[model samples]
Target chain A: MLDNMSLSRHISGQFNAELESIRTHVLAMGGLVEQQLTDALKAMHKQDVDLARRVIKDDHKVNAMEVAIDEACTRIIAKRQPTASDLRLVIAIIKTITDLERIGDVAESIAKVALENFTNKQYNLLVSLEALGQHAARMLHEVLDAFARMDVKAAIRVYQEDDRIDREYEAIIRQLMTYMMEDPRSIPNVLQVMWSARSIERVGDRCQNICEYIIYFVKGKDIRHTSPQEMEIFMDNNR
Target chain B: MLDNMSLSRHISGQFNAELESIRTHVLAMGGLVEQQLTDALKAMHKQDVDLARRVIKDDHKVNAMEVAIDEACTRIIAKRQPTASDLRLVIAIIKTITDLERIGDVAESIAKVALENFTNKQYNLLVSLEALGQHAARMLHEVLDAFARMDVKAAIRVYQEDDRIDREYEAIIRQLMTYMMEDPRSIPNVLQVMWSARSIERVGDRCQNICEYIIYFVKGKDIRHTSPQEMEIFMDNNR
Candidate 1:
């Protein structure tokens, strides 16, 4: 018969494997979402309706991945009954996938803007939007990297990056407003661009949310709704 | 010593009490969020800056409640190690609080719109927005009622209500676009109104999400991302 120690070790090993599998799956989902965002941005820049439509079609894949990962996490919780850091990791994964799924939705929405007709001047307005989308995509990429490493420092850096994304979004909004005022006839098209910009801006916020989940998983602190100064002080004091 | 049956019953009783407490707290949080949405709508219609400011300030209370309830749920999961339906309930509460917190944020943002100076014409535009906000608030109220009852049929009904909310939102958008095209100088103010309308529309989506959570808790099905027809058929077949 197996000894108690051996049996416990075997169970622990199996639990760790389960956790590792979900982690890998989450990173894979993140990569797919990032690809969606990047492809959607390309579709907008190139006016590739086919690519945009593909992005929309692929969103179901992202949603499927979320549901799958969520089930795995739930199973782990029910079977392993993880406590302390282990439990926090499962909870964070659950929340993080929700945010990733939302980013995919945002990407799909941005791609829809590509299907709308735009004059050349209006297409010019998309240049700023492309810049903003690129910024958000980079944030998503770096945040996923931070997530993979579970690096609190890297998460904080990505969290701070949202401010730059916000500034870029504000600049685009101002430009769109000016464009609308200059040629009132372009209001409809410009409004579409504005909505796309708004959607991209939300991606930054969603990425920041994922970063908070990373920190929460690592530090076991719920750092959401905290001001930047407060977060910094908490990190400094804890470190 | 107590028998195994009595000891198990004792533990189950305590677990039930813990679950019940969190459920009560969630309903309380839902009530606060509903109040915030209603007051924000009132603030917009009446141009009441003080009420808007109060809504913004009171948002932190909503955030604090979410954190507290989340901590409690995490503790229950760690201690009780709830299985099956119990596990789903805890998980649903975790996701539900996140959605409720977001609705609070939407309320806060809409209230900020009241702080902006609006011309009489812009104020007239807010009448349609008021109608939309009221519709969203009702959905929220009914969804919370569904959540409290754990009624899948009620949840499905509330989920269906979101389509009407979407239609109302689209109509408001069309009105705003026409108004903006007529008076280009009103672009900035109209954009703010448009954003407020968008935020209120999101509350409908968030409520629908809560309804999904309620159904998931009761039926153990993940109904997210499903079309209305698919959802209806699933409900009918399950019934």
Candidate 2:
């Protein structure tokens, strides 16, 4: 009789507890993604094929985290029939998980590229790629922090970081193109590096996506397609 | 008073009609996505830069549709507090629209590649690319069809088509690599084509995502991470 009573009380508390629990999962997953990117970048820098393989294998954990979070969000919505901010939070978590999952995918792709760079000597663009990875990982970390705090201004700052990553991505692409043009022998390896660079660029996009959700969660607005200037203004006003 | 009365009535009827209305929006958005991919593919074939540019610009319409549908879903959930299948349907629609928006992004990316190809002559892989796009677009069309009817069998068949698209994508990538090796001068153009091919391959992924949602809606289960063999068995038994 006591166990049944406690179980029912636990279910009752779930309405308030679920959001905080989901946020915990999101942060845990964010930490894993950030670590995955860091490890992948290190693997690429050192050409450690073993570390690269581990990153690839560890992606399953990230996938599992997403499912756990999604199921949590779904369960909360079903039982609570949550409205207003609770509803928005559940919806935003769903969106945030998708972005987080995509970041894991990108990290996995980068790890594969890291594996490829082991086979042959490639250009010395690892420095640039490492810089790009750091920028993206920091952006992701900052965005997740902003999300936790529901800080619109902090999320807006993360959005601007995408531009820096984009510029770096373009520069790396140009360098890859030049290298490919000059050395036909390096085409395959260069192609792999191009893909890795592209994946890093996509990480920037995932960061932007997370920041957008943070804005949505706080402001009750979808600013994904908004102009940059407008987004900035809205963020400032909300802050 | 009449307007207010009718609006309240509409909100009250939203429990059943909301799902149907969201379905209409989804199909409308799917139709536009299908059209965008078709036009983007067509632009690649004709090398019609003008048509490609138009496709790029037209992507905003798809984005707008996403926001509109999203708002509708949010409004329904908040006002109706729908339970059971109605809640699941609303949540699934939210997921589906994300995939649809991604399709729009991919289509826009393809259009940009189509624009790039016109800068200088490149390898002639458009025929294969067009075939891949058609397969993806068809898969998308069929999945949306299955979704509308809640036909698990049809959705399974659409899921299987992803294997065909992946194979075609690999074959095209090989062809592009061969072309790149033979002619270093074509590096830039070939890279753009490669990006476009990669985007098409991702479309196949988005199709599978939609099919997963269909199964979720029908079976009240999330099979997104399920192994194909298990998914098949579950679907067969469920059927």
Candidate 3:
């Protein structure tokens, strides 16, 4: 017969494996979302209807992954009744996937904008949007990396990066407004471009949210809505 | 000395009380969010800067409630180890509060728009926006009521209501674009109005998300991303 300690260890080992599996699934989902955002941005820049349609179609895959991962997390909670850090990990995963799924929605919307016709003059706005999209995509990638490592410091860094994305978004909006004024005929198309830019900027905010989840998981403290200085102070004191 | 049955009953009763308390708290948070949206709309329509500021300031209360409710849910999971339907209730509450918190953010952003200077011509757009805002607010209030009752049918009705909000949003966007084209000088103010309308419309989507959570809790099925026809069939067959 197994000794009491060995049996307990075996159960814990199994639980650890389960947790690791879910974490792996989350990363896989994140990778797919990142790929979607990248391709959506590319499709917009290149005006590739085929690529845009593919992004829109593949959104269902992202949704399925979210539902699957969410179910897995719920099952783990019911079965393992994880406490403390383990429980936080599960909760964080649940919230992270919700954000990731929404990011996938944003990608699909951006792709839809790509299918709309843009005049030659409106092309400049797309270039600015491409820059903002790339930045948001990079933030997403880094935030996911932080999530993978459960790195609070890295999460904080990603959270700070969102400000630059916001600035870029504002600049693009100003440019779009100017374009609309110069050529009122371009208003409809510029408006579409504006909406696309807004969606891409929201991706940055979503990444910041993921960063907050990472910090909550690691630090066991909710830092949401806290100012940057406060977050830094909390980190320093906790360290 | 208590019998086994009595002891189990006592423990279950206490667990039920705890769940009830958290559910009440969720409703309270929902009420606050609804109030915030209503006040934000009123402020925008009446151009009440003081009221708008109040809404912005009161947002922290919503954030605090979310953090507190989230912590309580986590604590219950650790302490009670609730299973089956009890577990689903807790998970649903967790997800619902997240959506509620986001709706609260939407309210704050809308209030901020109220503080912006709008030309006389832009006032008409605000009237259209007020109609959309009222529709979204009603949807939020009704969804919260359905949540309180755990009424799947009511939830589904609110889910259907979101289509109307989307159409209203599209209509407002078209109007705003025309205004921008006609009076390029009004572009800046019109754009602000456009953003506010978009945010208010998102409140409807958030309510729809809450409706999905209610169904998930009641029916124990994940129906996200499913077509309305599929949802109806699932509800019908399950009934």
Candidate 4:
């Protein structure tokens, strides 16, 4: 009986090691995705088709990472059958990785928009978009940090910042409308920028989704779509 | 040996019952959310504050349903320790409920916009708006059916129809912009209508997310952010 208990403990330790390995791969994937978004936005601002092409090419890496991480998760779940907190952590990571992978897709969408507008007349409006992209990238980094650390407080802060991206998105839309109304010649170009802004806003939303996963991992509750105020109150009571 | 076998069968039976209950609750929640979107759009068309209020009130019920379903999932996952396909089904249902709840929130946002514009001047643009709403409502209904029935082929059809809502949303935005440009008096009401249209477009996007979840549940592959054509090929090959 003693030997059997010792062997089970050893297996549980191996499962934790496997889970950590998967987490490491996911974080590396997140880093590549963040770079893709950043470079894509910068490419748009500078009208550098080369950087845009790089982003488009890097999506394959993201896709490959997604497949590997997914396979790792499946094997872990099937082999380890982790329970309780371990189970929740694995589940949260699986769902959160999917969201992260989708964020990479949006980044690819932004790169496509940038590439499409490369030959068009450059919009002076791309400057404001740089701001939106920067904010989104910063949020993504913070949310990933929150996820890695399992910091519910940090995740809560990132969730609060989603409204900032929404405000930026609305501002961009109104500005694009103003430009389109002022000059029909700029309509197509502005429309491309609108799609790009929408993509960035989507990235921010997915970052918030990641933060929600962090809350779930740490607190074991889903606080998505609820108001930030309510989240704070609930987090306070729960903690 | 007979008693042990009977106890094991009884536990397995309980697991199946819990799975059925989860499926039933999710479908019921999906129906409630779909109805909220339809009624909110209808209320906007008819300028019926009463209907709008009902949609708003029903959002609370959707929230309650989401909580009930999530708790059920938590209890089932904890008590049953489901493995293999059963584990996947539970995780997929948990994620799908989150998507459904977000759809409910989007409907509430539309209803709130409807209420805001009720006291203001009326716009006759509600006819096209009503058509757009009906299209979206139908799409939601079909997708929900595909989900409940686990009909992957039917779910793929819903995925194909999502573009229709996207095109309608773009057209409405352009029409509203043209109206605002031609007549400043139409700006406020038309803008609210545009906001509602955008919300409806997001609802369509959420439906696509649900379809992706359906594919995940049925096929055990993540097709999200992948090309639809490729997904169709995958479904063919795997099936």
lDDT of 4 by residue, B1-239 (tens): 22223223334576887787788899999989988888888777777789988898888789888878877876776677676666667777877887788889878877787676533334576666787788888989999998777776777788878899999988987886666667555555665676678778877888888887777766677786567688768757644
Alpha carbon deviation, residue A109, candidate 1 (Å): 1.0
lDDT of 3 by residue, B1-239 (tens): 11122223334577878987898999999999999999999999999999999999999999999999999999999999988677888999999999999999999998999898876767877877988999999999999998888887888889889999999999999988887888888888888888888898888889999988988877778899897688779767644
Ranking by TM-score: 1, 3, 2, 4
Task: Give the lowest summed-lDDT range of ten residues in model 3 chain B.
Answer: B1-10
Top model number, lDDT: 1
Every candidate's lDDT: 0.89, 0.81, 0.88, 0.76
User: Model 1, range A107-175, lDDT digits (tens) per residue?
Assistant: 899889988888898899887787898899999999999888787788888888999999989988998
Off by over 4 Å in 2: A1-14, A117-120, A236-239, B1-13, B117-123, B235-239
Candidate 3: residue B60 Cα off by (Å): 0.4
Q: lDDT (0-100) at residue A225 of candidate 4?
A: 47
Q: What stretches of model 1 exceed 4 Å from their correct place?
A: A1-12, A237-239, B1-12, B227-229
Score residue A88 of candidate 4 by CA lDDT. Answer: 65
Please count the clashing residue pairs in each candidate, in the order shown: 0, 0, 0, 0
TM-scores for the candidates: 0.94, 0.91, 0.94, 0.84
The candidate, 1 or 4, that scores higher on lDDT is 1
Pairs that clash in candidate 4: none
Clashes of 3: 0
What is the DockQ score of candidate 4, to 2 decimals?
0.22
lDDT of 2 by residue, B75-128 (tens): 888888776566777788899989999999998888887776343346366665
Tens-place lDDT per residue, model 1, B155-178, is 888888889999999988998999
